[model samples]
Target: MYTHTKKPTGLCIELLESQGGLISLEDFHELWSMLRKTHSLDHLYPLPTDTEEFHLLYIIISRDQEHGDLGIHANGYGIEDEGKYRLAGFACLVVPPNERREKSILSGNPNGICDTADIRIALLPAVQKRGFGRFVVHELLGHAFDTLRIRRVTASVVSPVRPSHSAAQKKQIGFNTKQICRIFETFGFKFEGISRGAVMNTEAPEDDKPVWHDVHRMSMLVTDYFEEHIISSLSTIRSPCHKLPLKTVRLSPWDTMIQRQEEEKRDLKLWAEAPKDTLANDACDEDGENSDVETMLGDDDVDEHDWDMANDFDD
Candidate 1:
């Protein structure tokens, strides 16, 4: 469990493990419905049709605050209530299907190393733009690197694209490529190039054809975390580049095949012919014009009272 108190507003935020089963399925469904209504689901990959699919992953639940001065006991749990400690949102760590090592560790294999996991986070519209996302992510990274001993953590953000007709009607969702990059970069995550046509744009299809959008991939290694700490401590020293001493591990056969397939897909020309209006800005192009990108939110420098409808959605 992790707890944070926001200044001025006195809003207390807590991150709890879903293993406690404090939230019910029915309540979870209701929260999902709210996100959909607010179009917060626009940037996320489609959720599993079966809600129960979420049960298998490691989940961190964000809530309002401690129940009372007593606070939640280490072993005890709190039920959602209107007065306080309501459900805010959640962050989940999902192991890839092909990731046998992490899967084994998650399944209680004594010798397995939990080396990697994909992270996703979503917050309710009401609680967004208040530094909660940053707090949650900070605690999550500490837990992943220190407690879970995960070597690598991966995250992806949908690159900004021209809004389709349907998308134009709904409120914008998620952060733009620049905002997301800034957020993760501040946390020591390095850009890992873009995945072309990685996700379907279900909101706007052309002539009954599916429209795909590009995704920006980013990752942070445990070594990167240590390097960040060292750099922070050495405030006066400036290093042009720092390299890891560890050698890259050989990929497994399955991973090699998957990498090859991804390379092949990137080389294909079909995705390039996508309509101009629907095309996404090249996230890799540092100088590319990103007029489509939205203004960033949740920055400490920004006015705390200036609330926006925008929320976060990760996959």
Candidate 2:
């Protein structure tokens, strides 16, 4: 069902250059705006008001393969030129990967384990079911699990402004609603739960925050990836993971915890043996040891200080 977008049937997907440096912030605003209209999404990252700090977010753009003319649609979506490029699908990974609102993920831990990826994908209305959605999702997960070596991937289902169609998407009257869910499920994505109006609970009351209409939370594990077609794309593109050794080195969580405990105890012992003034001077030395980790990697509002504040935030 995937439409051929000038992309050869077997070539690896090119990780569109990072939007921060290669693409302008304005381009992303245009892209998010274009997707919001079609997907009925209420908000998009680097929100318009967030116009200044666009560099904080990462963007991936996937062009839809046009069917009839085999020409991409221009002005119809986010693609700059019509016949040359059409915005078929995209996934945005907002940073820093963890916000203060999410501390269980980033509290004094290796973020590679907390490498959470949020994706918001949309295809032009004209090219819904030619099988493009399935292929795109496969590629996204393939990259997340294999190429980029992301720890997990998550995306929320977006509903249209009005009733569009029934499930299964057998007809051509409306958008393909199940495509998003089915694509992830096919790759073994698990349904975490709903957020805001996750299901029929769209009308239900939320605690403290205003009630939202519809949002479904779904996630997938990102290791031991097995989609051949997508994997082929990675090989062709030479993603970063291609350079990593093929063998996976699995580690025991229990062993890791024990090591951390020993290290923390060692630090505590050091403090007990040192005088108060020595401890103050040692603090200066500690800065040199922790200089590499003073700030969060992919986000602005989430540093170590914010992480502590996050612990106090009501879940």
**lDDT agreement with native, every candidate:** 0.58, 0.46
Give me the candidate number with maximum lDDT: 1
Q: State the RMSD for candidate 1.
A: 26.0
The model with the greatest TM-score is 1
Q: How good is model 2 by TM-score?
A: 0.43
Estimate the lDDT of model 1: 0.58
- For all predicted structures, in order, the TM-scores are 0.55, 0.43
How does model 2 fare in lDDT? 0.46
Error of 2 at 160 (Å): 5.5
